[model samples]
Target: MIIVHDRKDVRHEFDVPEGKALMLQLRPKKIGIIGLCNGNAACGTCHVYVEKEWLDRLPDPDEYEAEMLDEVAERRENSRLACQIEYRADLDGLEMTVAHRS
Candidate 1:
């Protein structure tokens, strides 16, 4: 399951396919909130803040994602590019906020 804290409202999705990128999974449900780069790490629009406790559970951002993160004005210790994350069974309870675009 993926839980998103958006617009002061909480949303959840439980049927995400494993190995699908997080950005792709969020597209239909989240609409304009993320994935402006079409799942590529080209844009900073898909930035998100991973819950602190789940930070270590996720892999470190790749070079492309890292570059994008650095470009995001909202970048924080827990920030990540949704396009870089692959939904997996281990990430069932993952939670994050859709970051404001910079």
Candidate 2:
């Protein structure tokens, strides 16, 4: 189960199958997350702030993803493009807050 905290303070919980992209899981829910690049890592529309505790657990963002993160508002140590984040069995119960667009 991945727990998403939207900008409106609403908590959305859903089952994230292993190997699925986080963006794919979110886009259909209409919770305001957008994967503008269709999970190609070309845009920051799916930006999200991972919980501080889980930050270290995720792999470091690649160069392309890092560059994209810079274009988003509220970029932080935990900031990441959701499209680049994949679901894994170890990531069960992962919690993240969707970043608001500027």
Candidate 3:
């Protein structure tokens, strides 16, 4: 179960199957992520702030994702592109908030 919060602070919870990335899991759910670049990490539309407890649990973003993240107006120490994170069983309870666009 991945828990997510929207810009309006609406809480959302859903099961994320393994093998698919986080963005793919989010888009179809209409959870408020834009994913404008379709998981390519080229746009910052899929930006999210990982929950503090789960921040260290996810893998570090690659250079490309890092660059995209830098472009997000709401970037923070916990910010990450959903496209860069793949689902894993260990991430069952991961939590994040969709980043607000500028």
- What stretches of model 2 exceed 4 Å from their correct place? none
- List model 2 lDDT by residue over 1-102, tens digit each: 999999998999998789988999899998878898999888899999999998877999999998888788888888998899899998989999999898
The residue-by-residue lDDT of candidate 1 on 1-102, one tens digit each, is 888877555666456889988888787785445677797888877788889999988999888888888888768999998888899899888988888764
Evaluated with lDDT, which candidate comes out highest? 2
Pick out the ten consecutive residues of candidate 1 with the lowest summed lDDT: 6-15
Screening candidate 1 with a backbone cut-off below 3 angstroms (N, C-alpha, C), the clashing residue pairs are: none
Candidate 3, superposed: residue stretches over 4 Å from native: none
- Model 3 weakest lDDT span, ten residues long: 27-36
**What's each prediction's TM-score?**
0.89, 0.96, 0.95
In model 3, pairs of residues that clash are none
- Expressed as tens digits, the lDDT of each residue in 1-102 for candidate 3 is 999999899999998789888898898878778788899999888889998899788888899998888788968999999989998999988999998887
Model 1 misplaced stretches (Cα beyond 4 Å): none
